[model samples]
Target: MLVREIMTTRVVSVEPSSTVKDAALLMNRHNIGAVPVVDGGSVRGMLTDRDIVLRCVAENRDASTLKVSDICSHGAVTVSPSQNVSEAINLMATEQVRRLPVVDNGRIVGMLSFADIAREKAGMEIAEAISDISMP
Candidate 1:
């Protein structure tokens, strides 16, 4: 199956200039852990709940004053919507990422997550991916 076959098409994203609090609020409202940071019609970075906690809260930075660009992880690993599920799995495992932004024409079109893979009944792949991601 292709990434577009299982990816979440309705992606919720944030701007690079958006506040950390705004990103966190979006995550809360969407019940998601991460938000793609976009700028000028392109994905610039990825902001995660862990990024807020560890980079802002843990560092005593005010989230309201901080920009998503200040805490977001840049150069995020991405996949094409046309890629196969196995390719996505391999990229996830190799990159130690739980999610990948699905890009098309330099624009983010969707998100592919480990949960999406698991829903495809690829339990062993999920397990292996998780193990690789969690490795020390």
Candidate 2:
């Protein structure tokens, strides 16, 4: 299987200039944990719930005044939609990331999460990848 086959095509993305509070609200509304930060159709980074908590709340920063780009993980590791699922899984483990943006021709195409892989009946692989990603 390929990444595009399992990736969530209806991705909800945010702009870098978007406030952290706005991003958090968006995530909450979508019932998602993260959102890809995009600029001109190119991925800039990823703003995750963890980022908001650790980087913003923990630091006592104002979420409403803070920009997603300020707290988001920059240079996010991305995967090609055409890439094999196994390869994408390996990359996730190596990068210690639970999600990856699926890009096609330099444009944001979709998102691939552990849930997406797990839904594909990759129980063992998903377990191992989660373990790897959870490692500090």
Candidate 3:
């Protein structure tokens, strides 16, 4: 199975200049934890709920004034839509990321989460990936 076979095609992303509050609201509305920060059809970074809480709220930065680029994790690790499911799982485990942006032609086309892997009937793979991600 390929990443495009299981990845969520309806990806919700934010612009680099978008406000942190806007990213948060988009996450809330989509019921997602992270949003890829994009610029000119290219992924620049990744902004997660934890980033907002730890980097903004805990640091006393105003979400309304802060840009997604300010709190987003730089150098996003991504996968190609044509990659195999095992390859995606390995990348996620090695990168300690629960979700990965699926790129095609330098543009984000979808998102693959651990849940997607689980749904693919790779129970053992998911468990191993989770363990790797949780390692200290």
**Top candidate when judged by lDDT against the true structure:** 2
Q: How many backbone clashes does candidate 1 have?
A: 0
| lDDT, candidate 3, 1-136, per-residue tens | 9999989999899999999998999999877789899998899989998999999999999999999998899989999999999998899999998889999999999999887787576677775776466332
Error of 1 at 113 (Å): 0.3
Cα lDDT computed for each candidate against the true fold: 0.88, 0.90, 0.89
lDDT of 1 by residue, 1-136 (tens): 8999989999899999999998888888877888888887688888888899999999999999999998999988899999999999999999988889999999999999887888675677775776466332
**What local lDDT does model 1 show for residue 81?**
92
Worst 10 residues of 3 by lDDT: 127-136
Q: Cα miss at 96, model 3 (Å)?
A: 0.4
Question: Where does candidate 1 clash, by residue pair?
Answer: none
Model 1 off-target regions past 4 Å? 123-136
For candidate 2, report its TM-score.
0.88
Worst 10 residues of 2 by lDDT: 127-136
Query: In candidate 3, which residue pairs clash?
Result: none
Number of clashing pairs per prediction, in order: 0, 0, 0
